[model samples]
Target chain A: MSVSVRKTYKLYVGGKFPRSESGRVFQPAGNEAVNVARGSRKDLRDAIGAARKGLATWSGSAAYLRGQILYRIAEMLASRRDGMVQELRLGGLTPAAAQKELDNAIALTIWYAGLCDKALSLLGSQNAVQGPFFNFSTIEPTGVIGVIAPDKPALVGTLALLLPLLVGGNSVVALVSSHAPFAGLALGEVLAASDVPAGAVNLLSGHRDELAKEFAKHRDIDGLLVSGPPDAELTEAAADNVKRVRFCNLSSAAWSKVERLRSLSWVEPFVETKTLWHPVAP
Target chain B: MSGSLSPTEFRVPPVDAVALEARTADLATRSIKKDAKVQGLKLAIAMMDLTTLEGMDSPGKVRQLCQKAVAPLPARTDIPSCAAVCVYPDLVKIAAQAVAGSGVRVASVATGFPSGRTDRRTKLREVELAVRAGASEIDMVIDRGAFLSGRYGAVYDEVCAVKEACGDAHLKVILETGELKTYDNVRRASRIAILGGADFIKTSTGKVSPASTRPVALLMLETVRDHYLETGKMVGVKAAGGIRSAKDALRYLVLVAETCGDAWLSPEWFRFGASSLLNDVLMQLEKQRTGRYQRGTDFSTD
Candidate 1:
């Protein structure tokens, strides 16, 4: 007789999977043995800390390296297809719905993985200025970004918003859907398997309302991305740090409209333009 | 002259390692938030020994450090100046000159600091040099080689010699507790340093791993508290090295206030030997005022 190894989904912080520091856990589907870490504000704080530090290397590294790492994440996601689909199904999706969700998530990852190195050249500009001055503008990562992923299309919604941020070298701290946290928590496992640097992608499973305010208000978070409906309170809290706040449409139908969801605009919101002026001596 | 009373004269009580750790861990859970947090953080800044002990530290760098020590938050005038700016013997003059008339003392780490591997004559000379350079505080390391080899008297005499060499400067004896190996050793070293005229008993040299851990700081604090209770002498405790966060610094404050009462909360009685800790404290203070977490980029690197 073989005994299956049950999984205790935990928070992915700074590239390591740790049980909640508070030692709290909850069942998403009420499975007897399966428990997801109920992450706290402290966990979010730790994740943000890691993301801030990770932004230096994530953004500093050559674009080619980031693309290759994202490609690795895609490969890891494909390899872990069975587990992801299982998690999606566990979150009340039909088997076919779960498979489609997993497929869309992987496709989004692969799409952004290929576009990582091209973001700068596509968005940047070299300006023709007055004599003795050569001025040029380049696109830079928006630094640490906080993601509030939607409840519906849990896996796809997360990947749709998260993958684009990484393509531009933005380190992310994501608070996944509270209703269907299983798939998102499982994605942490896939991210861990990939060569994704610690802190580059931290995934926490908890209530969106509870963490959304803290995520938006965090001064270290340079940008805030919210999926589903716009939250006025979240937007107001984000003003405390003057964060670049962007809301995304992560509906099931929107996921099918690939052109809108997979465009440069998705990546544009999380990048800042840095223009530099240098003297050209004759 | 200070070593007349041998450290061995008093049988040093062995520390309860498990209990000590449990107590520190319990004390760390104290919820110091809101107004208490802002107040505690500013107090931490005030108790800070803004240190830059790198081999590459230049005169300009020391001057800049002194500048930061004097005005931690230049935009706001509410923040108090740091307790002192801790540097090496060579840079003491620049640091002293920069912090002069600013109420920020200049402390120099001397006597083969981080490693007490030099002779008595040379060690005392380094202390003398720093004092002559206008440093009001002298941080000297204890000879672990002597202390480990059961030469307590020699170590005691060395601290006394360095203390006398300090002249008017307060002598802070660094135990380099990471090298001490055990709680019993730390307790014994604390007693020896205090008896040998240590105005302060510091934890580590920043060169060693396991520098200034909570339990170690608590043990050292306990020794100081015991000494104060018995002899009515209030020797300061500077938990140097490895104390790089505002939260950890505040816990040291909590440890002091709990073990020795509120008397040790002031900069004169307690200090934190740290460099990066200052920015973290400033960030926290800003977070308190602005109601948002802070960014390291917003603050000055020094």
Candidate 2:
């Protein structure tokens, strides 16, 4: 009998793969035991620190350049499509369904990449005034964002929620679904090779119940994107820092609606608007 | 005072790295919550030496730091002010003026600070200038080059000279343990600093990695305990750098209480050399009171 080699899926932090500080691991479906890093509150704290440090550089990049990087992510995903599809199939998805989901993930990434530069024009405004002054309003990224992925359709749902936030030039610390964590780990590998800056997108595979309160209360995170029903305790904790929270009801809406998923509203929640005025002489 | 004795006369036993790390890990698991947590948070706040030692530091920045040291959170009167404001020597006068009536002492980092590479005369002169500019405390760095080269006597003598230059001001000797590899070096450096007349022995300059780690702080606290047992003198310990959160600060508090007893818990015997740690502690205190976390923008940056 021949022995097959297996891979250990570690958490992506600061653009590097590291085991959990707690030194614990869990088995996701279709994978061997001790593969995924079972992250703790300390791991969450370290991820937040990495996101904060990457914010200045990621948010300061040109919109066009950011769009190019997002396109690069789609290309990387496409090249690794076969491996991802196989992993998804082993995690309980049918062959045809797995292929469709992979296609949707790539399409959604490209769609968001194209909208990076155009979001400002659609969401911003030029105010009309009676005085000799020119005024305008513009949107800016809201620093580091925290995300919680839903369990079902783990791959597409996570990409749909994450791409919009990244397109808006904000860094993310995402906690992948505990049920199907292998798909998220595969995506992390693709992101590492996609020219995405280190610390721009960190992925953690662990129990959501253990980390939700930390995601809400961490002082460094500026906004949160949670998929599924609104959690009362988590929402209340987020109020302590007055951080912005958006809940995506994946069960209520169709996941294949590209127009709805790619709308400007999805991007608006993670951005802040600033209005500027200047006096013009006659 | 003991000219006949050599620097190598005092000896420190070898440290068990694994055992020391395990002990620190166990102490970190102690849960401090509710009333006890609030008290710990307040005590930690009172032990802070709010520091800013950047090259870009100006008179205005030092004044802002002083203001922050005096009234950490003005809206909440229950919060106690910090122990002192730390800055470079040139800005000592400005910092002193900013906290003139606030009862917050001014501390200055001398002896070429992060790197003690200069001559003894220059180092002593720097100490004198800071004291003349109204610095109530001087934080001096030990010459790691001399100590690493097996010249323990030179390192001890330099610390003594800086202590004399401080006059009546309290002296804090920074070991810069990150540069000094091995636990034995840290143990020996702690002994040298205490016997050479350090009012308080510090762990780092906050400019290097592995600054003020739990094991390092634990070892230094033990040194203070042993020194007290032999000479009947109580020396303080300051854990600077990389201690950012309230939970970490609480762990240091636990180490001090468990090792050296509660006598060293007060600000006079313990201090935290940090700048951003104050805001995190305030946020936790507010969370305890309001049952919610606070926005960073609600607090002042300085």
Candidate 3:
């Protein structure tokens, strides 16, 4: 006799798979076969803590090392492409659509990987100042970020928002769309194997509206990406902490161009521009 | 100044390490959530002994710590102040002045602190100095070397001397459980300290790895309980060092209630000797109140 083992769709926080601390799981729609972790605010807090620790090592890492890690994520995704496609299909995606989503996600990863090393020179510049000083502008990752991942085309949608931030060295605590979390959670497995530092990317499967306000109100989430329909509540909460909130259109349809997703617009919002002033050496 | 009875004369039962560990492990699984969780976190906050015992400690740091102990979350008046602010003997005066009007007491560690390597005379003098300097509670370390060498009488006498020198202040004897290395030794030292008149029995100095563990704390609690049953006197238990989370603190509260009954549940009878545990408890309380998780930047740091 053979015993079959089932996969558990748990939250990926701090590079580890843990069921919700609340011990609650929910069935999405009519799918009895899928029970996703109904992440609570406590779970979100833990993800932020892990992301903060990951930020230390990730942001401190050499830009070249970060590039290598992003490339590794792309490599792992390519190897697991078929499995991911099948996983996405479980979310009601057609065979061809699932394949395209995985391919675009992989391609997007590669695009951002190349952008990592060239980020400084390409995004920063030297400026002329009136005084005897060289004024220069540079870029840095904006610490830990919370992303409201787009609901449709889950994998590619999350990566579109995630890759640019990671390329800039910001660790993420993302809340994947509750409707289709299987593929997004599966991506966590790919990132884990890809050598993205433990907490560099965290994913939670739960109601976005419930967690989005929490993401904005959280004092440590230095930046947030609200991906879908505009929420006035999240906007009000982010104002309390002066948290930098960026809204992006990540509907699956928008991701078809792929080129638009690869631009500086995504990377610009997640980076801080620091201006430096130095007297010219005598 | 040796104990009244010979060390071998006391018929203290040998601790069953596995059973002790299993009991404490069972306590760890109990779920204390929502309203009860809020109560426990507040209790954990009140039972905390905010400690800063570094060689580089300054008057400013001690005063700042005292301020936090007084008003952990300045915005919330409902939160109770910590039980005490623990520091070295030299800084007790500063802590006492800082927490003067506040109900928070000043506790100073004497008897050479983490390592009880000093002579008995110097140790007693240190305790006296701390008591004279206005520390309401004195945390003294036992001569672990004497306890380990089978010189139980010497260890017993040192505790007695320190307790005497402490005068009106309560004396909490530190076993430095990490160095004790065994459940049996922890129990024996606890018994020795209790027999010699300790107001409280603490686990570690917060300087050693494995400073406090569940099994060790359970063993100490059992010793205290058994003594209270034998005699009517009750002694407090402080699980110090390495306990950093609100969850871990709640499990400890459960252990105390299970082993020693609800009477030991108060900060007067039990304490957590930790430096970083206060903020985590505050954050948990805030999470309970606001339904949103907290970040470190929102709270003041030590």
Candidate 4:
């Protein structure tokens, strides 16, 4: 691959970044000629398809690999802070606030990177019962995750939620903020630049609620990470297929990486509780 | 004048053939055909039984526990919020303020709860005071002497008076079934409360001998089913006392679902009068939908 080939870095669907089938484009960076691809219904369908395929592989991936990949992504993100800061400025953040936003983004990445391994350490334990057999339980990754990024820190909050689950070996299908698609595409470009697997992160940017209902209702999507107000309708819709719902109150004054992980912890539904019982052969 | 129901006034259901025939017919029509599923499992959770939580050395700690008890339920894929939080008449204000604007209702046990020994006028006054103090619901205990001694009229009249005194506030008439002594008394008391205009009939004040039991709950739900048929009002039912877990809440939901059908599924009609139970239900729901165990202290509404 040529270094300057400009990979177009379109919506990642089915392990590939393809231009939106809609042919619709928006000026995410507000620069002429360089239009950001707007995702379409087909792209969402393809994402659901990709998530269905990657769910088994990602969930079965070793937790150590998950943690290493996550840490690597955080390191890559740290190296690209200037580029992210510039993108934030272009997306309407003030210089001072952008600096703070950049800090929060980096902090969030590092924080979640550290948590990548600890989640299993904290959630798993050995159980001692009266039965003759040794009982062990470990927290497992939920299947595919659907994320609706926060509208304000579009990239940072998205990455905050995305990294934790991804590090825990969960594939994600993200519908990013409508107003801040540039930072999302930029991050996607960065993920592509890094060695993050093609199907590991599928990022779609565009429209406030274009695919939210579908995302919530998608049968293949096991868990939903929502970083906004509790949408009762969407929540009730998720109930159609019993999707695990994790809603983050972006309006709350207090939010941190721990809160993001705790919110995203709802992904445990896809974890299969395997009980090993060996009967004595008579 | 208020001690016990006169012996002459006590009416017994037919032990003879003619009365037995009518009873059997009534049982067949009601139990087998229409309301066949009415079975009760206790669901009410009494808030702090504290007549004075302020007297405790650590009111702040108690207050924190109470707040923890009333924490917002975690999102659940199945079932719904069980019941309103029941507090003392004094703490009704705190509870109302604590859960202000929250979907959970504030219920204060009033009208001489548990004993119901206060005068009728004072009882009505207690009801009025609680409602004015911001209690969305009131759980008033019935006078067991009048109920047991077969002074049905007096028992019925007192409940009606308390319900009227409640004004717009929903009145939950606690039968103190533990003191009522038998399933028959529990059934009759439930009937009397419903006939007397109870919006919801609860099990006990959690201050009696055997607060709330499955058998008692079953009898009451049966009465509620009959009452609903006789009068189309469709009053709510609450099984208070000893309910303190998510599984407990679900059992109550199963009871309500089995007995009252899906209409009573809303928190409006069915409630678990629990203090520590809400958190468990929330944790279970969180675990069921999210797969993590969150302690009651860890999740806070305020």
Candidate 5:
């Protein structure tokens, strides 16, 4: 006779697994209700703190190396495909839907991985001016990004929202879908096992409502990328810090446009463009 | 008379590290909110020694720091000016000039700060230079090498010399307890500095790791309490380094209040030697006032 091991879903902050500081756990819908970390505002704050520290190294890496790291994430997810399928099944998805979403997530990771180095040239510009000077514009990653993943297709939605932000070199503090957070937690495990640096992508498993206000108001977070309809209260709260807020409604039709999802426009909002003017030699 | 007690005469009873840690942990749980939280936040702000000690420090940076110390957030006049603007001896004149009428004192780090490796003559001269440059407070580092080698007398004598060199200027002796290794050494060193005429006993230079932990600070506070009981003199305690948030600062205040009683709660009795802590305190104050969270970018980074 053999015994099966059960996994405890915990918050991934600074690339380390930690139970919620509040010591509260919630059960997501599954055959067996697994205990997931019910993160608090303090947990979100800690994740932001970690992301801020991780941003320095992640944003400073060469674009090519970042691309390679994203590819490694795809490789890790592919290796864990069976586990992801099982997680999706437990969350009430059909086996076919589970396998499809897992495949889409891996493909999504690879899609963004290919754009890391190309984002700059495709988005940046060299300008012609009347003055005796040279002017050029280039994109730099926003320091830290806060993400709120959607409810359905947990694996693909979270990855679709997160990969674009990460490929642009911004570290993320994401609150996974409350209904199907196990997939996000599993992805976090894959991310940890992959070469993605600790703190580069901190995953918090909790209610979006509990963590959204903090995600908006945290001074350290530079931008917020939400994968649901735009929330008025969240936007208003984020206004206090002037955080850049962008929404991605990833519908089935939207997901079909893989090229559009992997475009420079997708990565542009998560980055700031700096235009430098230098004096020309006579 | 050297005005220094013989190191052999002062006795530091063995500290129960476990009990000290437990007490600190218990005090950390006491929550202050509303009016008390606001009052504690303001007190923490006033006790800050807005410090910038870096090799790359410039006149422009010192002037900006002094401006911050004086006005803090210009729009919020309710926020009190910090206790002092701490900098290198070389920047004392500029800092003094910047906060001339603002009541923010200029404190210069002297006596081979962060490391007391230089000779006594050079260290005393450094203090004299800062005093001449209009510094009202001197933050000096003790000779950890001497203290660790059982040369307690040498360490006490050096602190006394630095105090004499300070003249009217208040002396803040940085024990650099992170380098002191053990809690017993911290206790003994605190006793020696208090006996040697340190107006204030500081925990660290903010340059070393393991700077100013809670249990170590609690032990130092106990030493201060015992010293008062023994000698009838009240010495100040400044928990410097690693104290960033208003919550952490308030915990230190709570430690002081519970350990040394309410007398040590004032800026005159307790101080925080911090550089980036001011802005965070201001942000928290703003949140309390407006019931809204703030961003770091909104505050000026001097």
Candidate 6:
């Protein structure tokens, strides 16, 4: 079966895939029509706008609905597993490891779906107090997360990491791996088709160095999930915005427990424990 | 978000060696004597590892030693409460009660005490237990093994996790300097710890023989002072282990005064973790004026 692919791969800004604000498009290796360039300040602002808009409803959404949306994305990705493998291989995954890549992708989705409920379960609390006031602690979403997905796991763990942050009701501005732009573009397609609420996930694929720096210093990006060892420049830039950075150190070959933290890294990036104190009343 | 990047904003500034020397001179001439039963002296900061107390002396004996050290200061003038009293995980409560209402804070070394080779959950648990036991400050040693092994993410994550475990208490990260030999390694460790949410970047636990040198203290303080310049957050610095005299504390204080500034010299930003050193500072003050050694009992351990 021959697939008639589109001539252009637009930038995923807000909820829809659109051409770059600069109207620029560049091609990565092995791709016909995908642009990997610098996203404009306007594109960043729009994603931030979408994130601010979506934060309430997404976080307010029931965990079941969040899990349902995530599980559905995984199912859809699984359904198109062969195409994903091809995309991964195109991005440099060996043909032998393509099946394992698909499995990892599927498992990542499910694992994150499970964690949506687990996060609240493990981190939340109801205090049995000495007073008549009702006090409880819930795992609140840290605003918009800035994600730099791993170049190696462009299809699976990267998307896996992104899904949990979104499902946890946090929006994200992702700098998809430049090396694996196709896989990121494909994942963006699946997210857009699902009920991910548009700006919840924005995929900016172009110059990895440029996008990573932008996300690092962008005040709009509340936290960062650096999917690999960020260079000193990137690390220093992220520090500029006081963006909470989660350095995801997944090697090019193996995916380990470290992968699990990438999801949490993004989710809790902007989290600050606000200890509210009130005088004990009569 | 990828693009060509500019230079980092978190670079350390040049040390004011001249200004530091001047402060040392000023400290030498100042008459720090007081009229009260317990006289307050401005000695260099001492940082204790708490775990080493096992070989030093008994708890009662240590308490007596602390009382004697503080005895020369004026009764109610508040001589900046012996920097801080550091102890093991279980002794935070005892230390807290011991130093209660005395302006002295009780710090407990947690996160596996000597080494940080544990799970996040376990590390956090150590912090939680220490905090719950009345530790006003927590000194957690970083996993140097993980850090040296190039596990930067794990190190960063663990430090943040331990910080969270501290609740309202301050967190002091100990970079066992004897282990992290080079100045560059010490600098990197200090920056990483401060960036990852440490309240203080300390040098050494004093387990090794050569603990808490001036250069290592200089390196950690330089990083902390730079962090303050960048973000405007005042992270404290503590020099621990083998700091046994007022002169030793003075040298570290001189370094802080030079490396950071006069603003950081207050007890809030400076600490000395010595068990037997406070008395020496008091003794020095007494010797400066009176030329005779007072009997140990003449100084009240009240």
Query: Across the candidates, what are chain A's individual TM-scores?
Result: 0.94, 0.95, 0.96, 0.84, 0.95, 0.83
Highest-scoring model, TM-score: 3
Clashing residue pairs in candidate 4 (N, C-alpha, C atoms within 3 angstroms) = B44-B239, B44-B240, B44-B273, B45-B273, B45-B274, B46-B273
Poorest 10 consecutive residues by lDDT, candidate 6 chain B: B1-10
Off by over 4 Å in 6: A1-6, A30-38, A128-134, A230-232, A239-241, A256-282, B1-302
Pairs that collide, model 5 = none
lDDT tens digits, residue span A1-282, model 5: 999877779999998999999999988865354788899988887888788888888998999999999999999988988988998887788999888878878888898999889888888899998899999999889879999988877787788878888878899999988998888888888998987888999999888877888888777788999877788988998887689998887776676444555666778789888999999999
- In terms of docking quality, model 6 is incorrect
Q: What DockQ was computed for model 5?
A: 0.52
Tell how far residue B110 is off in model 3, in angstroms: 1.4
DockQ, per-model, please? Answer: 0.80, 0.32, 0.59, 0.01, 0.52, 0.00
Report fnat, model 1: 0.86
Question: What clash pairs does model 2 have?
Answer: A240-B293
User: Taking the tens digit of each residue's C-alpha lDDT, what string does model 3 give over B221-289?
Assistant: 989999999898999999999999999999999999899999999999999999999888998898778
> For model 1, what is the C-alpha lDDT against the true structure?
0.88
Q: For candidate 6, write residues A1-282 as lDDT tens digits.
A: 999875465678777887777676677777655545446655665566577666767777888788888888888888888887887787777887777877777777877777776676555666677766666666667777877777766776577568767656687787777776777877878887778776677887667665566666555566787777657777777665466777777655556333654466545544443333344477
Candidate 3, residue A234: CA error in Å? 2.4
Candidate 3: stretches off by over 4 Å: A1-5, A27-32, B1-4
Q: How far off is residue B66 in model 3, in Å?
A: 1.7
A best-first ranking of the candidates according to their lDDT comes to 3, 2, 5, 1, 6, 4
Mind giving the per-residue lDDT tens digits that candidate 2 earns over A40-98?
88788788878877777788888888899899989988999898997677667899988
State the displacement of the C-alpha of residue A1, model 6, in Å, after optimal TM-score superposition.
10
Give the winner by TM-score: 1 or 4: 1
Model 2 lDDT per residue over B194-268, tens place: 878999999999999989899999999999999999899999999999999889999999999999999999999
Computed on alpha carbons, the lDDT of every model, listed in order, comes to 0.88, 0.88, 0.89, 0.66, 0.88, 0.68
User: In every candidate, what fraction of the native interface contacts is reproduced?
Assistant: 0.86, 0.36, 0.64, 0.00, 0.64, 0.00
